[model samples]
Target chain A: MKLLLTGSAGFIGSHLAEHFLAHGHEVIGVDNYLSGQPRHTRHLLAHPGFSFVEADVSMGLPTDTGPLNWVLHFASPASPPHYQQHAIETLMVGAQGTQHALDLARRSGARFLLASTSEVYGDPQVHPQPEAYWGHVNPNGVRSCYDEAKRYAEAITCAYHREHGLDTRIIRIFNTYGPHMRPDDGRVVTNFINQALAGEALTVQGDGQQTRSFQYVSDLVAGIAALMALPGPHPHPVNLGTTDAITVLRFAQIVRDAIDPTLPIRFVPLAADDPRQRQPDITLARTLLGWSPQVSLTDGLTRTIAYFRALRAEQQPVPTSGPAWMRGAADAGQSAATPGD
Target chain B: MKLLLTGSAGFIGSHLAEHFLAHGHEVIGVDNYLSGQPRHTRHLLAHPGFSFVEADVSMGLPTDTGPLNWVLHFASPASPPHYQQHAIETLMVGAQGTQHALDLARRSGARFLLASTSEVYGDPQVHPQPEAYWGHVNPNGVRSCYDEAKRYAEAITCAYHREHGLDTRIIRIFNTYGPHMRPDDGRVVTNFINQALAGEALTVQGDGQQTRSFQYVSDLVAGIAALMALPGPHPHPVNLGTTDAITVLRFAQIVRDAIDPTLPIRFVPLAADDPRQRQPDITLARTLLGWSPQVSLTDGLTRTIAYFRALRAEQQPVPTSGPAWMRGAADAGQSAATPGD
Candidate 1:
């Protein structure tokens, strides 16, 4: 298969590109690095199956990325602070970026997948959100730049599928963390791991009582690989995340234990429009895709902590060399070597 | 004041352009005629203070729309049937159209207005939804092309105001019906009026028991004019809809009585994702804009019936001449002469 993946310089996207390439598929990756780290793409450039295009998908796909079998849109800044800082760009990338990617897939007669987020559930009124749940979203709030934009992206993706006979898939991803997450990305998992590794107090938002379901990146991309390979008109959105819900404080403790148990916890004010509870009911994914997360919270943390520790040890913002922990993440988590390896 | 109005050939936009022109304001009206009827602007084009630009706002605002004090973005396929028929274009217009209009406003140092809709509420969970009620919307449903698009528009509009300090206003317009509405447009008011006038059974969706609030176009334009004229950093969205909630059955009966007392109603299957109860809590509009619906249902229906009757009698689809009933809407409902006059 030939594939075009947007945001391939980012965490999930880079992982997706590697997975497809390892499966003997040709992959063309595109990104402008607005929020993505270039070092994530460094290893993939060595793979003969992977090519790179540096451009913003909001304008359009670059012309030279020849015909494709599939186009996966995984662009846009995912974290709250990053999206808020580039609100206009985030909104543009999500809406226009998704449109351009869908257009490319339509023209190429390729199946399309849009990497949406659980943020669409928006402070879930339902304990475990199903795809059937219509979200409670603020259209003009500060977080709306990301939330509303993703919703709009989902809307446009479905429009293309129904109106243009385009094959499309949407995965509402819950929190996922592993190798390649930036120390400054402001996501909770990286924040705690990096803080613990740095021997600083782990900063937890608010009371840290709010629960979240976190999926390991290997588990997430594993689900993505299965979905891309599965053939059907199976057009509905699927939830991809661990149902192993945990409180922020408890998750911070786990991270601290993995890196350094002596690290203290620092509490901070919660951001606006933050979701109180997030957990996905992966009934459809389990039944239809026959997929469930494999990586345990403990093992995933041990691996992610190693990557950040190596990152800190290398003294580069995003390490240039393919550290053993990073390679372990790319190998679908089988490798158990420590960062020193 | 000089104003640039996108969708000026649209039903609400034409009325708005006329209002501003009558107040000695120069107006540049733009439309692609995707959903807007060309005849809606026939009268406005005659005014020395008014000019027309035929272009899609989604592509970009036409280059020739001169200097302006305000830019009102009202260009999208508003009716469900029309939007569904042009689903992709509708989505494009709402997002890109809104962005282009905002960019033009930013460049020209003009205040901006976004013509959002009650549809943004998307089958409200709260009765008489306030501006603060985060809406209940289906991101992948059939109606999402319009609903999510408008929500995206609102997000970007707020982004412009917050990030760039551009003055902006958003009005969540409820169902508005008046002279310029396409006879075939699927809105309940226009549908009922045209059906009764054509001596056909009024088509009512579902059981005809669902409640909806309909605002007269004159009342709506009056609110818009007031909001645009008054000056401040007033940034929150305002509901410019009426609280005159009525059942579809009762509204159909009123339309029938106005046109032909014996006309019957034909109930039809409900639309997918249709709002069961829709009524705006317009307290914000009443206090901030000093506005309320001045046209009673009876009066508004009477005028709307006259316009459709005039349309049917003319035997031309979208009659080109500016009939008295049409002029009455432009005058903000002061003209009371019968269509025969």
Candidate 2:
């Protein structure tokens, strides 16, 4: 199968590209490197089945990439820091980029999968978000860019599916962390692992009570591939993530144990519109796609920590500003501000 | 104050333009008229304060528009029939048009008010929907074009407010009905009124018990203006709607009575993602804007019925093709059978 993967140089996209290529699929990956790294796809350059295109989907699709079997649109900034920094680009990817990719997929008669996010379920009141839970989101909040763009992206993809009958799948991805995870990625798992490896205080937000379920990248990629491969009677979004919930403080402790025994943990104010609790109810994924996160957080963090450590040993500049852990010192402390009213 | 109003030729936008003009504001109104009617604004063509430019905001801003004091972005296909006809255009207006308007608002240091919809709360689970409901939407469903685009528009508007302090105000406008509505606008008010005027069957979706509160255009405009003029503190989305909830059957009856007493009513299957219930909890509006609906549904419908009667009496041709109510019953019936997956 020939697959065209957008955002193929990002953490999850790179992993997905690698998975498809290893499984004897011809992978054509594209990225503008706005937030993604060329280094992420460096190992794949020599692979016979993998080809990379440095292009922006928001500008338009690659000129005449004819007749592909599948297009996995993983473009757009998935992390808060990257999205917040380049909001216009983030929105364009959601609106224009998704449309362009869907157009390509439609023309080629290729199946398309959009990488949506749990952020669409903004600060959800439901304990474990089912596919049905309408989220409780502040549309005017600081985090609206990432959350709403993904929502719109999902909508446009659906429009293509319904109006044009393009084979489309959407995965409402939860937080996933693993080895190739960017050092400065603001997600919790990467933040904790990096901090623990550097022998720094692991910072958890808002008294460390906010809970999240972290799915390993490998598990998420497997789910993505499976959902795409599902032949029929499957069109709605599948919630792909671990259902096991854990407090941020507990996750910090686990990371401290895995990386360094003596690293202290600290608590900071939570970010605006950040969900207090998050866990995906993966019943549909189990019933339909027969997939769930197999890698435990403990195991995932061990692999992630080793990767970050090796990268640091090579004198890779640890991100000084962008990572979630280093936003501000305790002295710059303010109460946890919710996103704007 | 110089106000830039997008979708200025559309139902709500035209009304908003008139209000601003009457208030002695210079109004620069732009609309590509994709779903809008030039007839809606024909009366205002000669107004000294009114300036009209025909352009698509999704492409970019009109070159002639000057510094705006306030930007009312009411572009996009508001009616389901219009949106379903121009899905890509609808998506573009919500995404790109919104971005263009926000960019102008940011540069002009103008307060931005995004005309979002109750559609953002797609098939909401919560009743008497507040401004906080995230919405139960099928990302891959048929109606996602409008539902998700508006959600994304609101999000990007908020990002501008947060990151750039663009003075943005978002109004989750509920179903609005009044004079100057398109004859076959596909909204319940317009649809029922048209059918009753034409002495045709008043088609109700499903069992016709699905309820919604309709706000008069004037009342909604007042609420929107008050929200835009709000000073200090609460700039998030506030529900701008009436609390008068009525079943679709009841609504059809009311239109029938208002238009022609002899018209019969019929129940058709509901459209896909047609929200089962809609009533606004306008507590935030009352607290923030000191506003509520002034026109009752009966009075509003009376006025609307009169206007549409005049419109139809003038020998206006009702569109009769796909999804058209008259001769295009085939597609309507097909849509009823398989609304959206």
Docking class of 1: high
Q: Give the best candidate by DockQ.
A: 1
Per-residue lDDT of model 1, residues B208-251, tens digit only: 89998888899999999999988988678899888988998888
Model 2 collision count: 1
The list of candidate 2 runs beyond 4 A from truth reads: A207-209, A316-341, B125-127, B133-136, B228-234, B316-341
RMSD to true structure for each model, in Å: 5.2, 9.0
Error of 2 at A336 (Å): 43
**Candidate 1, DockQ score (0 to 1):** 0.81
DockQ of the candidate models in sequence: 0.81, 0.48
TM-score of each: 0.93, 0.87
Residue range A1-341, candidate 2, lDDT tens digits: 99899999988898998889889999999999998887766667889898888999998887577889999999988888888888878988999899999988988889999899998888888879898775766555677787878888887877777778788888899988887777888878878877887889999989888888888889998999888888973557889999888988998999888878898888888887778888899999999977878987777777777777766655533366655543442123211321100
- lDDT of each residue in B280-309, candidate 2, tens digit only: 889989887789888877787777776766
